[model samples]
Target: NLEYQGAFLYGEITANYDVRNHLFEDIKLRYDDIYKGHTLELGNYKYMDDGAREWDISFKKDKGYIITGSKNYVIKENVPLGSRVELLYLGIIIDIQNATNGVVEFKNDEIKEDRNYQLKIYTPDGKILIKDISTTSNYNQQNKGEVEYDINIREDHESKRNKIDSKVYYGLTDHLTLGMGYLREPELINDEYEYLDKGRLEAVYSNYIYSLPYTFRVGGDKVFNEFEYKVNEKNTKDDYSYDFLGQIDIKKVRLRLEHESKGEFYEDKYKTKFYVRYTPIKALDLEYEREEATKRDGIYGIDYKEKINKYSIEYSKAYKDLLLTGEYEYHTEDKGKYSFNTYYTGLRTATLKLENTWKNDGKDYEVAFSIFSNGNRLFDYNLEARYTEQEKDKFTFRFSTNYNNWFDYEMFVDKKGNQEHKFGIDHITDLRNPTAKIKNMDSSPLKVITFVDKNDNDIYDEGEELIKNVEVQIGEQKINTNENGEAMFYGVPNYVTYDLEPKIKKPNFLLGNNKVQVQGKNTATIVAHIPVKPMLTLTGFINVEDILELNSIDKMRLYEELLVTVKDTNGKVIDRAIPDEQGIFEISGLLPKKYLIEVVYMGIDHQIDGINDEIVKLTYVDVRHVS
Candidate 1:
């Protein structure tokens, strides 16, 4: 018998001896984790059982495999990674695992002598290289010939596959852009390192930010072509897909339309959608959508077509930090007596969502719950909570269930200040079957520390002070340090990367680095430093002698109310101050850098008197005396 719990499998075997004077030898069974690309061998002790014999099976996975018994495995070389291998005895799956490191290992003694043990390795015949398109950053606003490109590189965790993607955007005009993109992946078959390629071309016109703005886009993608290795000829049709999108926005209303067609030459499918939204008030929104789909299937000159239509309406309201939304949709299909689909019947669904957020004691909490009900059956129910303080130092929880068949819960908590804290076992179960329960647990931590760099060095010295109450951020959660100047984030998911940054609130203090990238699974600690520099004071006064020499009444009178402004080398305003009754003004907290000091009086703006030419350098001592 075989049982499944999430991504793991459990199997049991039993045998009985019919004779009282019979003696049995050692019996063994093997099982493997096909998803993780690993295998295991287990053996039972020598025994003679009159009734039945049983063995408890278990597995613990890691980078390497370990077996319970000493049995040598014969490995088949050059099998290739990602190839599915199956171990069969008497035409039944005794064990199955994927090849790792381009080889499959198995022992022949695990199978019965009466049956033939056969191993088979199968490879994919066809695969889709790219199914979605995405871009990066904002469009270029330059007049012409300006180009912006986004590149993405990805490699599988097992290092068996790689993907290289690139997208380019050219500014043909102020409101138009010409775009192209390409994606590459290795072919799934054959021995050589041949790659498959897909490309797209598009023309986009968007002026949505103006008073009367609209947008239109037209694009097409070239599909991948299949090849037949046996005939040594490329076997494919002239396949392609096209898409069109248009949107218009008026004061309180918006309209959008979209259409897409795929497989123009064979097995064609077309879809179209229309949407309208109206928002007459700041708290209320209403929307309506209509979608239609048509599919064609043809083989050996015999063709069949099918059509489906769907309509939906949605209403949402927002009050303070709480949002509520409800949607209802209906679906119908064109049917005939000889049709592949059922006769035209209406199917209805209704979904409701409620979300709320609040803050308490410098911590933020959020709760969102949504449910979808089709006819009288509940389809999905999802509830998520983030950073909700349970007692003192724990948060981040989620709960989801669907059709009463599946349930999932996730939570994470820290144990004191230790970074290596495991979450309590989460019971993912099928409610209809009480015996099926999967318990998943994990423990990992990410800690960030802030310290004062006293000697202006990049390294953290022993005598450097640990600054308390420094803010650190992982994702959107902002955490402050404890008394020890350390902040820890618990329940971080595995196999992901996070960008860590420090939120400094003090001026004239610079961080050593702006952002740091951290990977999950391993305990990560980042040390950050803030170096504070000394400030220079610029003090000056309107020269009485120059005012008297001018002799003009307007010139001398203007000296009484003089304005002084200081700007850095980048022309950013640093400080502004007006002289007191004595015509003496002072600006402090200015860094020791080049600056431009401007003196304005009597509708005239001119450079300060003490500045050399148009710039002033303040390094040591205060810069004084100016008219």
Candidate 2:
């Protein structure tokens, strides 16, 4: 039994019984997860190397004959000692042993005759080395100017007769091929062995014909029988066959047609088939097929005919996390039959299906369900359920089955009657480390330098001081300058533009460059000039005097309310200060330039040198006669 659990995974189990020996042969189990690139297989499976190699030993199927220098097949190469060595056939591990002294050996008794095998050597570096152990060659399609041939010989033990078959094909052109085949078989007739020889010539052409892709094959065969010549004095018979297949694809519609005819000595048969598939919309598809066959019997002078017609439609739609599909098929054969199937899938991992099939002899109804999990903290599993009902005439039968396989189990059997079962558990965890160092080969470094442009030049000078601990922002990364006044940003992608800004917030300092373009693998450089300004402070004293007509309280208030103002050369008030009763005042944060100081009460101005940091002294006299 084979079960396809969808496109991701599938399972198959097969067992054989030998009636003559009254014994049960080995049972095979195989499961494949295409999505994960995993396979588990058991029972009698053949192993072939993923690569190609030459065999050191040969085995013949007749009497299990082993042809080798010794009874054991030994492999000695660059293989490391203690490495695991596995003998496999058709991708199934048959025997496993550890290598000793860089050599691995298998006894002849464990090998089968006339079978292709492979040796899988597990290297120390977690690599598998595949070696072929058979003489089979790989087959590839014939290319232009290429020739391919195959020969086979078979013996009939009961009749003591041998048959030989050979075929050869040559590529006449890229799209055309010519082939020839010959078969010679022995027949036991009247206690004598007679041979019948058959020869055939064929040609195949595949190319576009009138804008439609097509393939056509024409062949003729002749047979020569020694026994027939002895009985009827005529031994040669000729026959011919031809077939044509063509397909056209236009937009969402596909049409295919095939016609074939075979001529024989007693009868001639012809068949033609036509098929079309159309998708009117993305979620709907329609298909139809018609086939007709006719046979003419030369001896009986009778004609027989048969025809088949098929029609099918499929519709599928998806709504968020759920998918629904419906399909119906009708066939015009065997008294006519039709089937309808529906499927519902959720979360892309679980599916439910219902099917109803009607035939002239019986009706079958079935329901199937399956679910798959990719594996988590617990374990991965595949579960399936099926129920079937059949009705024939007045009788009805029902059957139901279920399968739950945890993890994955694959079994294999060898020709030596040895069996091995392998169980696997899949667990996926996010093993990502945030601190892991991943290097980007395409990225380049960015160097940013910050300095005080003392000479007012855009370039950095030797005597100029480099500004240390200056933060620089490049793209989304921020780096601080070292003692060398260099901030380096690593892993900057090449050929991209980024904003390079020196985040300097110091008073009286300015930045020069704010953008940099990185290119190739070269390091990008950004120069930021943080020029400083010479700031100065000025101090002064303001004195106010009033007549003795008022009291001491009024005299103190007049002095305390006095104000002093400092202005630039253009008479724009740059700063102001209020003096205390002691008449002392000061002004700061002025650039190195000339400024004027004035007393607001007296309305008098005085010049003070800002560049030299001179203090001002002002005297204000209030002139009022006791009013």
Off by over 4 Å in 1: 1-149, 156-159, 187-194, 208-211, 223-234, 264-266, 280-285, 298-305, 320-323, 332-627
RMSD (Cα, Å) for all candidates, in order, is 23.5, 23.3
| TM-score per model over all chains | 0.33, 0.36
Per-residue lDDT of candidate 2, residues 215-317 (tens digit):
5666666666634335534324534466666655677887777787775443448889998888899757788889998878544788788888888776655
Tell me, by lDDT, which candidate is best. Answer: 2
The residue pairs in collision within model 1 are none
Off by over 4 Å in 2: 1-143, 146-169, 182-197, 209-211, 224-240, 244-257, 264-266, 279-285, 297-300, 314-326, 335-362, 372-384, 391-627
TM-score of 2: 0.36
Report the lDDT of model 1 for residue 481: 80
What's the distance in Å from true for residue 235, model 1?
3.6
> Candidate 1's residue-wise lDDT over 62-138, tens digit each?
22212334213332422322344555333333334444433456553332111234555443211111111111112
Candidate 2 Cα lDDT to native: 0.50
Q: Give Cα-based local distance difference scores for all models.
A: 0.49, 0.50
